[model samples]
Target: MDPGFIGDGRTVAVAERSSLTFGVEEEFLLLDASSGVNLPVGDDVLARLTGQASEQSRHEFRQSMIEMVTPVCGDLQQMREHLAASRKAAGDAAAAIGAQLVAVGATPVAEAAVSRPAAERYERIIRQFGPVALDPALCGMHVHVGVPDRELAVQVCNHLRPWLPVVQALTVNSPFHAGADTGYASWRSIQMERWPSLGPSPYFASAAEYDDAVQQLITAGVMLDEGMVLWYARPSARYPTVEVRVADVLPTVDDAVVVAGLVRALVATVTDDIRAGLPAPRLRTSLLSAAHWRAARDGIEGQLVNPLTGVLSPAWELVDDLMSLVGPALTRDGDLQAVTAGIDRLRVEGSGAERQRRIHRAGGDLHDVLVYLAGATTGSVAR
Candidate 1:
C-alpha cells in the first residue's frame, strides 16, 4: 500500500504500519511561580493529577521534577495529542499550588539536593552513587520504539552508537545553568555524564552479552539494577522496546514528536540493516566521546565531529546527512513530511537552547526564560 495518498495536493492519511508504534517519556522542571526557581513540589503536582485520564504524571528522582509517559501510539498525531494534554494537565496541577511546570532540560538557577521518591530503589541510588546522583537537576525526553525481540534490540543499540551524538545535537537544550550561560547547548547532557553508566555503550555481540554486561554493572556496584544502565540508547528493562535517551526534554510537544519520529525511523532502519547482515558502523570511543561533547557544546549552531573520520563538519550539513540516512524508514512509515516540516520549524525557531539564549541575550533574566519555557511548553508560542 502507498504510505499515504496524496490527493488534491494534500496527504490524506499516514501509514498504519506496525513499525510505527512507539512511545515518549518526558521529564520537566517544576518551578516556583513567584521566584522562578526550582520547587520540590512534584509530589503535590502528581497528587493533583492522580485521577486524570489525560496522561499519567509521576514523581522522578527529584521532588522538583515530574515525568509524563504517553501511552503507546502508532502515529505522530497521537503522540503529540497525548503529550500536549499531559503537559496541560501538569501545568494546571502545578498552578494549583502556586508553581508552574517548565519544559526545560535543567533548572537555570537552582542546584538543590536530590529529593528522591519513596521507592527503595531510588533510595538505593542515592546511597550508591552519593553526590553524583544528587547532582542531576536535568530533564530529558526518552523515546521507545517497539522491537521484534531482545536480540534485535541489542543489535539495533549496537548500530546506534555512532549516531547518538547527532541525535543529541538535534534536540539540544539546557544551555544555561546556575543563572548564567553555560556555553553548552545541552548542559544537561554534560551534567548526565557525571553518572558512570551514561553515554554510548560498546558493541555487544548478542543479547546475552548485553545482559551480562548490565549484570556486571550491577555486581560491581556501578549501578543498582537494569534500570540504571543509562546508555544513550538501550533496550528498555521494563518494556519490549529500544529506548533512545539522548535528547533533552524539548519545550514544545511538536518538537518532541519530531524527535520521537526520528528515533523510531532510526530503529527501524538499523534493524533492517542488521537483518540484512550489514556491519555496524565502528568508531573509536575517544572519537565518539568528542563528538558527543561537541554536540553538547554547540548544538546545531556550530560544527559536529564526523563519526566516520573524526572530521568536523557544519552542524546543519551533518543533520542533513542524518535525515538522508533515515529517509527510507521515515518515508516507509509516512513520517517524511512531518519530520521535514518539524526540522524546518526547528531551524527557524532554533533549538530550545538557542531560544533560551536569545531571550537571555535580550537582557531577559532567568525568570524570563522560565516564562518563555512555560509558553512554549503549552504551545502558545508560534514555533
Candidate 2:
C-alpha cells in the first residue's frame, strides 16, 4: 500500500520501512544544595536559563519541580546529546539559585508545603483533586514517538500495553518518599494511583473509540481535559506521536536515552506488525494493571508478569525478551549497541531505585541518597 500524504503535504511514512522521530521530556526536583530538601525555586531556575534552553524548560505542577523537553530528535545519539545539554543547563540554573536539580521520581525528604505554580489550570486541578494534587513532587519521564495519525497511535497504544510493566521495571527510580522507604521501587507510580485516570490505557480498536473514551471521562468530570488522560501510553494531544508515560524520571542522561531508544523501537516494531495486519495482543487491562503494580513494587529485582506468556518470570528475563523482540528495530536505527551497553550498566549499577537504596544503606539516611541523586542528575558522580 502506498502510504498517502496527510493534509500537510508531507509523506506519511510507514514505520516498518522508515525511521520514526522521537523526543523525551524529563522532570526534575529543585533541592537546597546543602540541606538536600525540596526547594520551591523552579521559577528562579527557569529564569536563569537563556536561549533555546529557556525555551525547552518550563515549570511543572509544583514550584519545586521543573520539566525539560527535548526538541524532536531523529536518533539516539542526538537524543543523548540533547538530554545531557538540557540537564546541564537546568542543573546550572538551579545551582545559581543555591539549589540543585535532582532527577529522581520523588523527593525523599518531606516538603513542609508543596507550592503550586501560578496557573489557573493548576489551581483548578488542586481544587478538584484536593489532597491528591497537594503533593506535586511525583516526577516522571514521558517519551514521544512519531506516528502517522491518531488511528495508528491508538493501535500503537494497544500493541504497547503489554510491555508497559517491563518499561516500568527498567526505570524504577523512586524508592523513598517523605523520608521513608515506600518499599516500592517506583513510589511515584503508587502515589499516582490516587488520581482517577491512572494506569494502562484500555484497548481501542480505532481513533474514534479512543476519542469517545476520553470524551466520556471529560463528560463525567473524571478528567479536566484530554491532556489529563494519564494513561501509561496514549495518542499525543499536541504532536503526531504516541506518548509513553510509564517510567519514572531517570537519574542520568544515559538512563533516559536507553528508555527513549527502547520506546521508539517498540513503537517501530508494533507499527511494522500493524502494517503486516498482525492483530494486537488482547490482554486484559486488569492483568496489565497487576503487572504494573508488581513492576513498581519490586522493579527488576523480582518476578514480573511476562508479556510473551502471562506467567510470572524473572525481571531480567523479561527485559532480555523485550530486547530480543525489538532488536531489529533498534539495529535499523543504530541504537542497539548503545541500548545494550546501557542495560548492561543497569545490570551492574542497578536501577535508580536500587542505587538509591544502596546509597541510603551505606550513608544511613535519605539525605545521602539526595546528595547522590543531585550528582547523578548531571553526570557529576563517578559510575
lDDT (Cα, tens digit) per residue for candidate 1, span 168-231: 9989989988888889999998989899998877788999999898999899998888989899
lDDT of 2 at 62: 87
Note the residue pairs that clash in candidate 2. Answer: none
What would the TM-scores of all predictions be?
Answer: 0.93, 0.95
**Clash number for every model?**
0, 0
The number of the candidate with the highest TM-score is: 2
Which regions in candidate 1 have their CA more than 4 angstroms from the true location? Answer: 1-18, 50-55
Model 1 clashing residue pairs (backbone): none
- Candidate 1 matches the true fold with a TM-score of 0.93
RMSD of each: 5.5, 3.3
User: The CA-based lDDT of model 1 is what?
Assistant: 0.82
Name the TM-score of candidate 2. 0.95
Query: Cα lDDT of model 2 overall?
Result: 0.87
